[model samples]
Structures are given as structure tokens and as C-alpha cells.
Target: MPTNGSQAGSKKEFQYRTQFPPDFDDEGESSGYVGFEHIVGTLIWASSQASLNLFEASNTVEAVTLERHFTVNSAPDNWQPPVDIWAQISFSWPVENSTLSLYGDEALCDLYHSETTHCRHQPLTANIVTELEIVYMFSERLVSHLDSDEGIEKTAR
Candidate 1:
């Protein structure tokens, strides 16, 4: 879960580690990314950056905006424990491959170019919902970290 804003009416979202292979020549790469519309976030009792950007939730039933709000604690034994357990991520159908459809809301489809921006908030009208789904539109990459105290400290850094 991520830390909420300092004040009410304020909002924040998570930024998952969706870096890159920069290019993908097909061949399904199994290890990278979160949906752009989904927001991944983290939290702390006080202010500290150990909290990692995990995943996010959709804003509406249609998920017009990214809103991942939840909480996780900084306990040693539980990768992320909660003084009280909270939801860290909100997911949708897994991403498929990249290809834009022109028949839908062209503007939003156009606006979301990157992996995260590929989807947007829609009215959730009957016509807007679909039985279809799309893939990541991009390839997934691998991420690695050294397992040690230094690695833990680096997460904060």
C-alpha cells in the first residue's frame, strides 16, 4: 500500500519499476511491468523512501485515473507488514500486447502512449465496457537486486 496525501482532497499514485528493453522484437518476455492506468504506491509511519512503488488501482469502474492507496509497514521479518494489513495494489486483466484500437475513445487512446498511460477514465457507460482485453502493448523486462543489508539500504536511497 502507498502513503496517502498529507491533506484531504489530495491524491497520489505508485510508479512501478517499468523501465525497459527499450525495444522488443516479439517473443513473449515473461518478466516486466504493471498497467499504466493502475497506480502502485507505498507508505511509512514517518517520512522515509524505503517504501517501493508497487502497483495502482483504477479510478472508476472504468478506471479513468490511477489511484493506488493502501498501507504497508517497515517491519524486518515481513517484507512489508502492516501495523494493520492494507492493500498495496489494484489489478485488472493482465496486459496483452500493444496495438491501439481506433473505434473507441480516440482521444484517450491517443493520450495514453506510454505503458502506464495506455488506459484512461471513461464514463463506465454500458457502451464503454468491453469483453475484450489488451496485452502490455510492450515487452516485459527483468529486474534484479542484490540480497543484503546494502540492498535494503539502497531501497531507501
Candidate 2:
């Protein structure tokens, strides 16, 4: 189950790796390049933020659902475990086709100039290249209630 903060059984783990295309450098030696590190770091940071936001939104929706099910006079004696949500998200950007002008080559400069004269770099266009999987679990009683025709009718109402 996914957890909040440093609680036990937290499913919060992050892994990141970067690869530069062979054409990123003229001689195919990316070791001497110094600018890409920042780009990769920024991508990682942004992806982390996006993951956190997704988690937060899921939690918020779960909380709202629980609260909506409670009423003034018939509150349950105990609350069930919150719905579990987990994500394995990945972000990828093709460096070779990047329009950021990270390189100072004349071809890139000419392309940038021909594309736009704003001098501001293009926005990083990253693809979320993984499926967002969310899992939900409830107590047996809650599941039974949820599966009942009355529950379905109530939800329809």
C-alpha cells in the first residue's frame, strides 16, 4: 500500500537514469559535455514533482469520497483503510531532437533562429512513457456494501 510521509510500508521509491544519444556530441564522446547534466537534473526534479502531485490528488479524491459517505447522525464507529495508490512513472525526452539549443553548433543556432527569434529556449517536451496504475482495496464489509444493488442505486442517485 502507498503511504504518507515516512510511515511504515511506504511504497515510495524513486529511480532515474539518463542516456545521451551518440550524436549529442560531434565525436560521439559525451563525457566532455557539461550542459546536459542540468537538463537531466531538471527533468528528474519535474517528474518527482508531478508524481507527488498525482499522489496528492488521488488522496484528496479518496478523502472527499469518504467524507461524503458520512452523515451527521449515522457515522461509522471505525473508518476503513484509505484507498491504496501507487505509480511507476517515467519521463523521457529525446535529446537528439531537442530544440533547446543546449549545443552551440551553427546548425542548432540556425534552426533556432529560423524557428523563432524569441531567444527563449523551447519548453521541454517530455513523454510520460509508463502506465499509471492505481490500486484500491476496502474491508470485506465495505466491499460487500459497495457490490450490492442498493449501493449501486445510491451511487446512481
Candidate 3:
């Protein structure tokens, strides 16, 4: 719930919230990264907020959109479990070109592993990355809107 200074030269503060896939801490098959269903649920909530124009009021958008522009199918050979169920869930604001994708599988596990001989040194795991990505996207959108007076124009839409 922290606020950021106006990068757009406006007095209004830009506020944003950090979000995680539901059941992010649950063990076993119920973990947040276990499958796409849980991730979709989170996106659904975000979409609902947009439909209600909640974001226009507070600049507190969570997940942005469930874009279906790309699709990947599972292959029998060189395949990983849960990768078959994977879907692209983008964490980019409507105005930003940068995107962070979340995938639930071995690559993610390795990306999240502690620095070791066999693992890549990625200190920020998927969850942390997702949270930070949302914050960054929110800030980017805020800057864009405030700088060009787009916030007012967008709200009027």
C-alpha cells in the first residue's frame, strides 16, 4: 500500500499494491505455482477489478490482463511436467513494453534455487519477481499517465 512520488510532475501520488498467486504458501499440489488454474484465478480477479473501473479510482491495479496472444503446446519429447499446463501470464502494464512471465516447472525451481554449483544464482524467486514486476509496471504506468496527462484521459474513457 505504499505510494510513490510523481514522476509525471503532478501532486497526486501514485499508489500500488503487491499481489501473489493465491495459496502461494500452501504445500503439495496446492502451491501457487503448481498449475495455471490458480494463476488464472488471480488474473480473473484482476480483470474483474478492471471491469469495475477500480483501478481508475486508485491506480492500484494488481494483475493486468490475461493476454491470449501466444500459445504453447506440450511435446511428448523433451517435455517437463506442468509445462504442458503452462500459460503465459504477463505482468506488464498496458503502457509498458517490458514483460515478466511466470511459469510453474523445473526451470522456475532452478531459477529460485539458492546459489550453488548446479543452480543459477537467481536470488529473486518467481514469487518475489512477480511482486516486484507488478510494482515496477504500476510505477511505469503512473509515470506515463502523469507525464502526458493520460491518467485523466484514460479515466474518462
Candidate 4:
């Protein structure tokens, strides 16, 4: 990872790892494990990391917008034929205004392209915005704690 000295103030590194069960075989040389658990776990873990990164990046700049594009090149050996997993997520945060917004206009094609679908354009209430800010703050703290060396040592013990 590269560092932006002026924006970041200091360089900080974070690492994440995924552990698979001993019985599980990822390669096809042996009987490959047939389950969605690992895939789901990886997605969840990546989402957490993305959230943390977004939070940190947003703090340095006025606003940060992120779009994650996922493509599935191949499916598990046990999966049935014709499996397609392609999705995109767009999230934005304006820290100065304490606003966090998610735009999924292109996430689901059917709903997004349908003409009959009526999307509301009402601005969120003050209370709702406050709640979102609180959630963001909490997530930042939780991610920081979980990424700390002390937290890792505690979990290991």
C-alpha cells in the first residue's frame, strides 16, 4: 500500500487474514470443499475492511466516494453450471456534513431499469442523519479496536 504523507499525517498499516478449516481443500488436486461458507465469510470480512478504509479515507479529505466491482471468473468445483456473481456497490460519505449515502441505482438491473419504479427523493430527517453518523462512528471504533495489536493478542489467547 502507498501512503499520502500530507493527507494521512502518518503511515499506518493494517493486515487481515482468512483461516480455512484443516479439512477443507482449496485446490482441485484433493477433494475440494463444497460450501458457500468460505465465500460468504470472505465477503463479510472484506466488507468490514472496506468500511474501515472508507472511514479513514473520508477523515482525511472532505468527502470520499467508493465503488467496488466484483466479478466471478470461476465457481467452486461443486457449484452447478451457469453460476453468475457480478455486483457493484457505490458508497459516499461527506464527513463535514455528517452525511453517509449509498447509491445502488445500478446494483439491481431490474429495479433500476424499470420505469414503474418510483424512487423517493426526500431528504433524510435530521434524526436519521444523526443516527447514521453515530453508526459510522461506532463502526470506526469497532474496526480500530479489532485491528489493534492488543485486540489480536487477546483474540489469540
Clashes of each: 19, 0, 0, 0
* Candidate 1 residue lDDT tens string, 1-157: 1111112222222133333222322323222222222222212211134343223324333344332223222323333422222333223332221111112222333344532342434322112212222223111221122233443535443
- The sequence of per-residue lDDT tens digits that candidate 2 reaches over residues 1-157 is 1111122332211122234333433433221223333343343455444443222221111233221111011112232324332333332233432322232222243543553343343322212222223344355676777678773435443
TM-score of each: 0.17, 0.21, 0.21, 0.16
Q: List the global CA lDDT of all models.
A: 0.27, 0.32, 0.31, 0.29
Query: What does the lDDT read for residue 135 in candidate 1?
Result: 25
TM for candidate 3 is 0.21
**Which 10-residue span in candidate 2 carries the lowest summed lDDT?**
67-76
Rank by lDDT (best first)? 2, 3, 4, 1
Better of 1 and 4 by lDDT: 4
Q: Which digits, one per residue and each the tens of the lDDT, describe model 4 over residues 95-149? A: 3122211111121222234534443522211121111111212245556666787
**lDDT, candidate 4, residue 32?**
20
lDDT of model 4 at position 135:
25
What pairs collide in candidate 3? none
Better of 1 and 4 by TM-score: 1
